[model samples]
Target: MAGLFATLAIRKALDKLSSILPAISLLASSSSAAAMVRQGHEQDLEDLRMLERTMHRIHATLKDAEQHWDIRDESAKLRLKGAQGASV
Candidate 1:
């Protein structure tokens, strides 16, 4: 799931970059073109950073869930063993 999110984020960034490309060409000789490119690059970097943070959070959540699941399984097994012993 985190991989899926990361892939989607990359696709979105690429889409944004493609859209910006034509505009950059239109203003190729203008000083503002450099500024625009710089700003766009900075925005993309920020977006990627945000995506990385989000992925980290998602990974942590998944790890926590898996740990809880393991604990639950162990508890269930112990209960089952105790119940069988009592029956015997």
Candidate 2:
């Protein structure tokens, strides 16, 4: 549950970054390492990096969700079987 929330938060942040990054690049102009990164319309580069990270995180989250779903399905199936046997 906590992991899901963290993954969702990161996903939301990445989405916002994608939308606002072009404007951010236009506003960024300086010679320092951080500032230089902002000068060359390189927000796309940052966005790409963020996307890669997000993809990795989302993949992990999906795997976890699938596993959880499988377990829940198995449990439900067992309960249904027990109920059917009792009815019989």
Candidate 3:
């Protein structure tokens, strides 16, 4: 469930990145594009930076969640084993 949401969020972020890629490519191919970036693309650049930070945070959070889930899963398995042994 957590993984599902994380995957969805990552996909959304990737979609956002795809939208930004053409502008980035333009910068590489055209001096006019470079000038446009210098003159009017500050907001787009800021958005990219913000998305980068969001992705970093998401990655860190997903790592923590995975560790927690692993611990919880192990604990649940042990509890189930203990219950079965008592019943027997």
lDDT of 3 by residue, 1-88 (tens): 5354554566576577768767865664564556665655656666776776666566565545545545357675464344333322
lDDT of 2 by residue, 1-70 (tens): 4334444555566677567655665555433556555545466656666775765566465445535544
Q: Model 1, 1-88: lDDT tens per residue?
A: 3333433454455466556655654444343557777677667656755655555554454444434534347675464344333322
TM-score of each: 0.43, 0.35, 0.44
Q: How far does residue 57 in candidate 3 sit from its true spot (Å)?
A: 1.1
Q: Is candidate 1 or candidate 3 better by TM-score?
A: 3
For candidate 3, the per-residue lDDT at 35 reads 65
Clashing pairs in 2: none
Model 2, global lDDT: 0.53
Computed on alpha carbons, the lDDT of every model, listed in order, comes to 0.50, 0.53, 0.57
Clashing pairs in 1: none
lDDT of 1 at 51: 56
> How close to the true structure is residue 84 of candidate 3, measured as C-alpha lDDT?
30
Candidates arranged by lDDT, highest first: 3, 2, 1
Reference-based lDDT, residue 63, model 1: 43
RMSD of 1: 14.7
